[model samples]
Target: MRNRRPVGIWLTTVLLSSGTLLLSALLAGFLAVVSFRHGWVRTSPLYGIIAFLLVSAIIGTLLSAFFSKKVLNPLIALIKATQQVAEGNFDVRLEPRSKGEVGELIRNFNRMAEELSHTEMLRSDFVNNISHEIRTPVAAIENCATLLISGQLSGAEQREYAEMIADGARRLSTLSRNVLSLSRLENQGIITERRRFRLDEQIRQAVVLLEPKWAEKRLELDIELSEVTYEGNPELMIQVWINLLENAIKFSNAGGPLIVRLSEAGGEALTTIEDRGVGMPEEVVGRIFEKFYQGNPSRAAEGNGLGLALVKRIVELSGGRVGVESRPGEGSRFSVSLPMENC
Candidate 1:
């Protein structure tokens, strides 16, 4: 989905530089010709010219080498690197040599290589993880179906197996839905259906929709929505709140407090959701927003690790920002800031 931009040519500068050296050599030769009549030339006038030309030629050779080191060496490295990259080796990296646009290009190319390598790693991990996740439910469903089809199964056994099959099917459905949602959000270009709507109200609705989870966990909700309205896709904003709130609820310890606050600050609508939950470590916090990145290993099965990634993409698409603050064994706080344009 991306292409390398064409770099500006340094050929003109190189030509000018080499031309300057040639001009200097010509000037030295002219001086040598003038000196031949001043009795300073011990040899023939033709010898003076030849000596000057030889010295000039040696310097020109050195200059050529300098220019080659400055320009051609890196290019050679780049060609080899490009070959590796083209052959499915994203690990190819170029060592930055000098300053200016060429240097910048080298740095950029190295960064691109690093990013590609990391992306390849993530893709491999995603494939493996997704396969395992799908297989677990599929194997369970197959086993449950086989048990139900057996003629020796009792009525209660048939019902249990059927319930298991339903659970497996639901799991597969959820996996598919999450994958689709993430794919859609990531590939979407711009926010559509922009309208001014009550952001706080939308959040409240999301809360009510997820009330069952909070109710089951005996968690308390303290909501302080301050008449905040925003301009963006309402459905997408709702999904953000749903993901944040559901995360808060899911990770929270039983009977803990969950606080959701919405207020206007610095020409932006700030929504802060804090939960008394099993928070994350610093390393985990840094990568929590990555796709299929689950920090809390114990609760890995509770999610497919796409919710926060989707939330981040949606908020960013709305020209807003999402921030997270957390510490292990301490509560976590998620702050989403939407620019209140025209507010």
Candidate 2:
């Protein structure tokens, strides 16, 4: 009842096979007339020839159906599986028999479905994390506002309430900015415009910018560099360093040490930032690069959970890669590799 052909190759085979049989029968009849009727035994090979033609036609039709069905069976299965996938079933899989184009098609479809499933999971997780992140700060601000409105606070208490409000606002601002940065980094329209810059200088600038934050915690700084110059956007790479360092300072125990190292390893410029903090578990570290992923979701850290995600995206955009090594209670070390080119 679907407004399309039932199957294409089936019809083609039927038509071609039937036409071949009819043409062969006519040729045979003509040859019989030339050899038997005009030259030799004219008694009649007519009934015998008629029987042969009928049998040949039958065999040709059967063979055509047999060959055509072999192909049509897999084709129909593929079509049905695609329809199911379109109807929101990512679990449907096609098992094609032979290793043909059709088999490759099915394999690719399975992969696409798997990827879609993973992406959907990530999207759902992101939505939930974002909702929780927003709710906590908003609820805190609302509670503080409610206390002030109910006249339950003295002058000093009111000042404290105002400071709480300011703090919530700052957290929200940080969340919004990180979200925007992550979005921009993920946008396909944003491609890297590589240029030459000193990798050591970039790290120094990021450290300088974040010095006040780390200094307030009395965190000791360690630096080692090979004076590496690389081709990349210095500003974007600076953001990567800042985010990693800021995270280190935020999560590190007070007076702990932070190490920032830049060096050339195996023809690549590598920057590593290691912190002595409450590190992540191995399981969490496996998916650390995923967007909106937070190893600690207790809302303890002042982040929107996009910093590492942004760092990974920016590194990939610059023809580089990012990786993390961490274990719970020990610490985390994040490394990024970029091309070591003079441009």
Q: Which candidate's lDDT is highest?
A: 1
Show model 2 residue runs off by greater than 4 Å: 1-17, 20-24, 27-46, 141-169, 187-198, 223-230, 263-270, 299-301, 321-330
**What is the per-residue lDDT of model 2 for residues 1-343, given as tens digits with 9 covering 90 to 100?**
2334446755776777778678768766766666676656555778646755777667766776677677677877777777777777778877757578878887888898888888787778877877877887788899999999999789999999988888888888888888777877777544467678888888898898998999999999998877987877777888899889999888888899899888887889888999988898888888767777777877455677788888888888877888888878888899888866554
Q: How does each model score on lDDT? A: 0.85, 0.80
lDDT, model 1, position 144: 90
Runs of candidate 1 exceeding 4 Å displacement:
1-80, 93-112, 327-330
Model 2 vs. true fold: TM: 0.78
How does model 1 fare in lDDT?
0.85
lDDT of residue 138 for candidate 1: 94
Residue 170 CA displacement from its true place in model 1, Å: 2.3
